[model samples]
Target: MAADGPGKKKHGVLFDVDGTLIDSSYFHAMAWWQAFRREGLDIEMSAIHRRVGMGGDKLIQSLVPDCTEDMQEELKAGHSAVFSTFWPSLRTFDSVRDLLAACSDAGLAVGLASSAQERDLEVSRHLLDAASSIDAWTSSNDAKESKPAPDILEACLEKLGLGPEDVVFVGDAVWDVKAGAAIGVPVIALTCGGISEAELRDAGAAEVYDNPRHLLEHLESSMIGKLMTGSLDA
Candidate 1:
C-alpha cells in the first residue's frame, strides 16, 4: 500500500470477493449444503445461499443454531473440502478486471475486503487476475469478526490507511449492506450474487446495479464516480 502525501486524504473502494467479483455464491451454498448433509442436518440450499457472505462459523450457527461447537468446526472443514473441488470452475464476473482497473485509473486505491478463507481468497484472486490494480486485500484470517459485523471491512480500511468516510464498499448481499452501515460507509450493492435489487435497496444500499459491467457502464454517475470527481467527500 502506498501512503498519501502529507495532508492528502486517501479515497478508495473496498470490494467483497465472493458473489461480487466472482461467481461462487451458489458453489458456496452447495458446499455448505453438502456439509450440512454430512452432519445429517439437511439444510436447504436457499437458506445457505442467503448467508454466503458470512464466515463459516456464523453461517453454520445461523442455519443451524443448535449446532455444537465441534459440529460447527466439522461443518466448516467439510464446506472447505467440498468448496475446494469447485476451484477449477470458479470464475470472475464480467468486466471485474476492467472495473477494478477503472477505479485504479481514476486515482483511487482499490482493496478487496473478503471474508473467505485465505486459500479460497487466493483462488478467487487468481481467477480475477486484476491484482495489479489492487492495493490491498483481506481474508477471513485478517479479521476477528465477519460480515454484518464490519471487522473485515475495518481490517481492509486499516490496511489501506483509510477511514470509512474515505471509501465506498461494493458487495452483492444484504449482509454486505449491513456491514457497511455499521461503520457509516455507503454501500453500492450488486444483484449478481443471486440477491434481488429490491432486497438490496431495502437493506439501505446507496445504489444497486446488475453486475460489474452494469456498474462500470454507469460509473460516472455512481458513488464511485462522485468519489473520483471530488463531488463526494472522501
Candidate 2:
C-alpha cells in the first residue's frame, strides 16, 4: 500500500542507494578495507564503516591521510576492484521492494542519486530492484562536485524536469543532507545505513527514521508525505 496522502499535490523522492535502501554499508567497508590493504594501509573495518557514505575519493583521502595524488588514485582503483568482487553477495533490506512499490503506487516519481560510480550505481540499481521502479538517476559521473555539494541533487532535479521544491532527498549520510539542504530540497534521513539520527538532524534533515519500512509504516502522517502532498511549509 502507498503511504497516506495529505490532500495535495505529491512530489518526487530521490533516494540514496548504498546504505539507505540497501544493506551494503559494511560490504563497502570490507571492500575499502581490502582496497586499503592493497596500498599497505591496515585500517580497521569498524573505522571504515563509520565513514561509509563519504564518496570514494573522499573516503580514500580520509582513511589514508597522507597520500600523494597517485596513491589516492591507486586506492580508488583498488577499492573499486575489491568492491566489484563482492557485488554478487550484496543484498537489500527487508520490505525495501514493498516500500518502492508503495512509492510508485502512490504516484510519486522516484530517483536514485548517489555518489557511487556509474558501474557501482548499476550494481546497486539491480540489487535494490530500482531498475524497474526508479524514474531517474544521477551517478557520480553526472556531477563535477560530489556530495556535500548541491550539484548532484540539482542535476537529478534538472534531469527529472523537476525543481528543488518538487522533490525530497532521502539519504543516510550527512553529505546527502547538506546537498539537499543547499538546494532547498526537503530531506528525510534514514539511520539504516549507519548514520545517527542526531547527525542527520544536525546536518539539516527535516525528519529522521530508522529505515524505509518505518517510514512506510507512517507514510501518511510523516513530514515527507505532508510535504509531498503540499500541506507543509516549504
Candidate 3:
C-alpha cells in the first residue's frame, strides 16, 4: 500500500459499487443461482441475494460449504460468464453521478471500495460517467480478502491516502456494513440493493437511505457532509 502525500485530503468517502451505485444485485443473484444449478446445487435466490456483496469465493463457500476448491473455482467462472450477459441491462441508481460529484465538490476524496472484478468495475464506472470525481477505486484483485473482512476498504483508504477515521462508507448490504465496521468506518446503508432499512440498521449502519438520490438530496446533512466539515469525530 502507498503512503499519504502531504497534499492529500484529510477526509474521504468510500462506496461499494454493485448494489449501491449500480442496480445489479438481482443480476448477480441470478447469475449465482444459474451457476449453482450448473453444478447440480439448488440454492434459493433469496439466499444468494443476501450474499451478493461478498467475494465470489466467499459467496460460493458460504452457499456451498462442502464445495471443493476445484468446484468453487468452476462455480466462480460460471457466475462470471452468466453475469456478463446482463451487463448491457445494468443501470445506475438515480443521481449516482451527482452524488459522487457532490462529495468530490465538498473536497472529499471519493474512492470505490468494490469487491467486483476489474471488468465489472470498468462497466460500472462507464455507466456512472463520473470518473473525474473519483479519487481512487479498488477491485477484487486489489485485496486478498473481500467485504466483511475490511481488506478492500483498507486498500481504498491506502489508494486515497486516507484513514478509516477520515472517511465514511456508502454501501447497500450487510456485508458492506460489516466490512466498514471492521475498519472503524461508519457506513451509510442504502435499500436500493434489496436489503431492508431494519436489516441495514441492525447490521451497524450509521444511517440508512432509499438510494443515491436520497443521500444526494440530503448531502449537506449526511455523514459525508459531516466528514467534509470536520464535525464528525474520529
lDDT of 3 by residue, 71-186 (tens): 99989899999999999999999899999998888888888888799998889989998877888888888999877899999998888878888899999999999999997999
Residue lDDT tens for model 2, 31-73: 8898888878889988888778777777777777778899888
Candidate 2 Cα errors over 4 Å, as ranges: 1-10, 130-132
Please, what's the RMSD in Å of model 1?
2.2
Least accurate 10 contiguous residues by lDDT in model 3: 1-10
What are the models' TM-scores? 0.96, 0.89, 0.96
* Cα RMSD of predicted structure 2: 4.4
Model 2 TM-score (2 dp):
0.89
Candidate rank order under lDDT:
3, 1, 2
Q: Rate the local accuracy (lDDT) of all candidates.
A: 0.90, 0.78, 0.90
Q: Predicted candidate 3: what Cα RMSD to the true structure?
A: 2.0
- Candidate 3: misplaced stretches above 4 Å? 1-7
lDDT accuracy of residue 141 in candidate 1:
85
User: Of the pair 1 and 2, which is ahead by lDDT?
Assistant: 1
Superior by TM-score: candidate 2 or candidate 3:
3
